[model samples]
Target: MHKFIVHGGRPLSGTIKPKGSKNEALQVMCATLLTEAIVTINNIPDITDVHSVMQLLTLLGVQIVPLGKGSYQFCAAHLHTDVTLTEIFRQEYAKVRGSIMLLAPLLVRFKSVSVPKPGGDRIGRRGVHAHFEGLERLGVTFCYNVDEEAWKAKCTTLSGSYILMPEPSVTGTANIVMAASMAKGKTIIYPAACEPHVQQLCHMLVAMGATITGIGSNILTIEGVAHLSGTVHTILPDMLEIGSFIGLAAATKSTLTITDVPINLFTPVWSCFRKLGIRLEEDDNSLHIPFQPSYHIQKEIDGNLLSLSDAVWPGIPADLISIAIITAVHAHGHILIHQKMFESRLFFVDHLIEMGARLILCDPHRVHVVGLGNAYRLRGTRMSSNDIRAGITLLIAALAAEGTSTIANIHQIDRGYEQIDQRLNALGASIERA
Candidate 1:
């Protein structure tokens, strides 16, 4: 029910650090269920989705202690053996797709676990076939219970084998990898997701005595271990959050510096934004975007329009597509924003068009943004956020608009970004939480 009243037409200048990866935190937190010893994780993001994952773990009998800000200790010494998940979990699972990750770790431990259909942003169809397929290869069987609308899964004798992921899905990769960690033989995952967060999970598992190789590439090999011990792991800075801040600086015409950046993971992002003539300076551990009144979209040397699309990795992340579109609204020249991964992701552009940006919604998956540079300004109005990325993208558009704007249903945003209004407010952006 929370809302953000954003006052527009102001530059946000200051330095901020991106929080720990929300996606990484969810995966690693679930990975904690794979061990009985104490596992301490640093840089846990204080966001709703993470809190939901933590709550799910606690409900499943994981002992969690707050070490301090952005840190926690977990010990899954015992878990409930009942077929039924906690009522609160069933009720809340729809809001947290991360809950689906509990399937593998729980299946490996309890031999059986039941969970309702997972939910998250309504971006598009996110199928669990990949999860069931990869785990099923390792001796897991799943049955759908019609009355409960849940999947009942059991793994009697876990054994590792080669798995070619149906897709490079981050969650699916983590789930199968965790299950494979306890499998009885060598497991080879070809075309695994090699995002920094996925690498973080594999590295964490290795540190905990799981044998893993190919840490940062599409192919990964794991030797099944007897058991995994607890280990301390620090999550990489959230690349999505880092990209959002960069887009904010470009939209608001501010010289902003983002510290604690995992710059190596953002090569494609740098190239994508630099195509818009936005200056992004990188160091060993931070990113800086200098103020620029206007930037032009670099077309193909042969005079073709620039196309920005989402790919698996070393490509512009799909999560950043929303912010990139809004940033493109304020730039010069025209570019095609393609959301090939999710049909619903680009639907939020209607609000930008309502705010006076020139854009063509070619279809559910494609948009053409005619960047007017400084010659144009969006006029803000009331809008409701439908998802995390779209919510933050709307906030950024409002900040660069000509008048105040109200964003409703900001809880979707709260689920992802931690204290975003407060953080952007610190950078001189006028965002009031109500």
Candidate 2:
């Protein structure tokens, strides 16, 4: 029932720091189950999804003590294996997508797990077949328990084997990496997701005494070890959050600096934004997005319309497509937006089209946008946030719109972005959480 009351057309100023990567934090949180020692993680985002993962850990008897803001200590020393025996655990486990990550780690430690089908964003059908298929190669067997709506998984033992990933899925890659870390033999994985978050997970696992090679590349060679000890790990700053801020500053024509950004992890993002002619300055660890009255979309070398598509790690992230669509509203030119990852992701463009953006819906996966430049400002309207990415996109559109706007079901936004309204309001933007 929560909603965000936003006043449009407010110029924003000041520096904003992005939170830790939600994807990395979630993956690393699940990785903690790999060892029995105390594992301390820093720079964890205080968002709903992170909190949900923490709850799942606690239900499994992991001792959680808050060290400081965005820092916590986790010890699985007293962890119990019969977690699904509790009704509360099953109920809570079924509510978060992150619960799927628990399977690989628990299977490595206890060799048996009863995990319910996970719930998460309804953007599209995100199946766990890859995760299980890869784990099954490690000597795991799965049975679906229709009565409990859960999957009963048991592993006699783990044996590392060559796993050519069906696709470069982030969670699937992470799950396989974790299971292979403790397997008995050598595991070779190719076409693995090499996204920054996935790399961070591999790096963290390595620090915990696992032998992993090719940390940044898609192909990873893992030598299974007998034991893994706990270690302290810090997550990278949220790249999705950084991209959202860039889109917001561009749409609002504001000069804002996002501090302490990992510019090295954002090659594709920078390329796409530059293609829109949005000027950005980079320091060693920070990024400066200057205020520009207008910008243009740069076409191809042969003067064709610019095309932005989401692909594997080296390509533009699909998560930013919605925000890019909003940024394109203020830039002058035509571009094709292809959201090939999820069939239903581009459907949220209807709300922006209603707000006066000159966009054509080519299909469920593509949108042709004719950037109106600064000639038109989107008029405020009431809308519902259907997913995390769509919610942030609406917030950006509302902030740069002409009047007052209402965004309902803001819980979707809270699942990923931490204190987004308060943070933006701190920079002189008006956002009321009602």
Candidate 3:
């Protein structure tokens, strides 16, 4: 029940390092189920979702030891349970979308798995039919009564085949890859998501003895292996966090150096920020954000100002659309933001509007932000978080606004960002956790 009370209008000027990617950590942790050897993972984010996944792994009899801060050694060699404690694991697993990633590894090891409907942002109808269909092509059988809320899946052995995903759902593709890793034959996945997180998961699996080709493309070829031996791997920096930091620095006129950014992983994101008139400098593996003279929105091809729109992977990510909306408010031009992935993501714009932002909510998925420019300062106001991205976006707005702002339901923010208040405080942000 903690909240963040932030005094706004402060320029954050310092060095900040982002934690491990939450998306990669969750899937990589679940991928441990495929191996019996010790796997060492570094740069793990200390977030609630990661804790929940660890709890689920512990319940399944996997041995996990915290070697040091942000480092963990996991060995699933002694995994002794085929049936998860349903009552205990259900609620925790449903709290985040990454929970669905457990299905693939579970199916490979135990040949049976039952997971409750995963919970995530209420953006739209995120169907698991793709996962089931992909698994079904590999000889998995699903049996459950939807009305009774009981679901189970079992497969004697999986034989790989071609799986053409209807959409490039990131988690769904990861699930299929995990399932295919230990199958009896080769599996080809088409139109798969090539997001950096997904590529990281695939590379980790390959490092752990899985044979996966196609590291950064839509089509993936996975060769089945009988067993996997664990290996030491380092998780990549959080790109979503990097994007959030970029928005925060620009909104607050801060100069920040984000270390270990994995610049190659965020090429599309970097391009998107450039279009917003935010300057960035990339070193070997870090990104430097200098204090900008002004943030301005680029014009459209039709000679009219256009909004930033979110699409699938390789385009702007849907998770950062909210952050972009807040960034638009501090820019020097008019821009529209269209959230095509989730219908409800744009609903949080009202909270920013209360802070004196000139924004028009065109619909559930569209917003028009007319920048207040440097002439006006947004006034801080109290806000409650509705989702992970929105929560951080509100915090960014609060940091850039005048006066003090209190953000409640910070647990939503904690689910993704690791020690966010502490990290921002280190960067000269006057934020305190209450």
Candidate 4:
């Protein structure tokens, strides 16, 4: 029940490095269950969701040792086989959707595993059908218990085959790949998610002696191995955090230099933000955004209103849409923010409209923001964060407002960003966590 009290009207300028990807950490940590030897992971983000998944792994008998900051060693030499659907596990599983990933690795090792329905942000209907479908294609059988709301899957021997994912689901792909790693034959996965984090997970599996081809493409071919040994893997930097910082710098007139960023993975992001007139300079490993007088949204050639939307990989990530909308509020022109992936995500704009932002909520999935372009300033007020992305977006908006603001339920933001208040405060932004 913590809150963040922010003092507004200050520009943040400093160098900061994005933490390891939370999504990647979740997937890679689950992969540890696929091996009996020691696996060391580096650059893990110290965030709530990641910690929760680690806790779940520990409960399932994975030995974890802290190697230092952002590093840990895991050994699943002994597993607590009977605790999968225990009451304690069910409670922890409700905290993160990534908990479902443990099922594949556990099944690969134990031949049977049971799990409760997974839970995550109420962004949209995230169906687990893709997970069951892909795994079922590889010779796994599952049965659901309506009374207990649990699913039990068992397969004495997994024989890999071709699996075309119904969608490019990141977690689903990770789950099936982990299972396929221990299967008996060649597995081909088409329409696989090729995000950097997904690629990182695939690379980690390959390091552990799994044969995988098409590391960064929609199609992946995996040859099952008899056994996998432990290997060390480092996660990629969090691209969502980098996108948030870029939007924050643009809206607040700050100069932010983000070091250790993989600038090439953000090709689509740079193009989208450039359309909003927020120029960025990048080097081999870092990116710099200098201070600007005013931001302006670029228009189309035929004079149509510009729009920023989310797509699969290589598009503006859906998680960054909220930040883009907040940046658009301070830019000069008008732009339509279309959140086609999730309906509940764009509903958070009501809080921004309450703070004197000129926005039209066309529907649950679309918003039109009219920038004041420094002609007017938002008056800070109280707001509650609905989700992780929306929470950080509101924090950025409060930092650019004229007065002080209070953001309650900051735990949502804490789930993704590691020590966000402390990190932004290092850049001269005044944020007090209570």
- Write model 1 residue lDDT over 33-141, tens digit each, in one string: 9999999999999999998888888888889999999999999999877724667778777779898888889987899888999888988888998888899889999
Which digits, one per residue and each the tens of the lDDT, describe model 3 over residues 109-181? 7877777888776666688988889989999898876864646888999998999898888988999999898
* Candidates 2 and 3 compared by TM-score, better number: 2
Query: What TM-score would each prediction reach against the true structure?
Result: 0.98, 0.98, 0.97, 0.98
Whole-model lDDT values for every prediction: 0.89, 0.91, 0.88, 0.91
Residue 402 C-alpha lDDT in model 1: 92
Rank the models by lDDT, top first.
Answer: 4, 2, 1, 3
In model 3, where do residues sit more than 4 Å from their true spots? none
Candidate 2 lDDT by residue in tens digits, 259-317:
97988878888887898889999999989999999999999999989998888888888
Better of 1 and 4 by lDDT: 4
- Error (Å) of candidate 1 at residue 391 is 0.5
Runs with alpha carbons beyond 4 Å of true place in candidate 1: none
How many Å off is the CA of 337 in candidate 4? 1.4
Determine the C-alpha RMSD for candidate 2 after optimal superposition of all C-alphas. 1.0
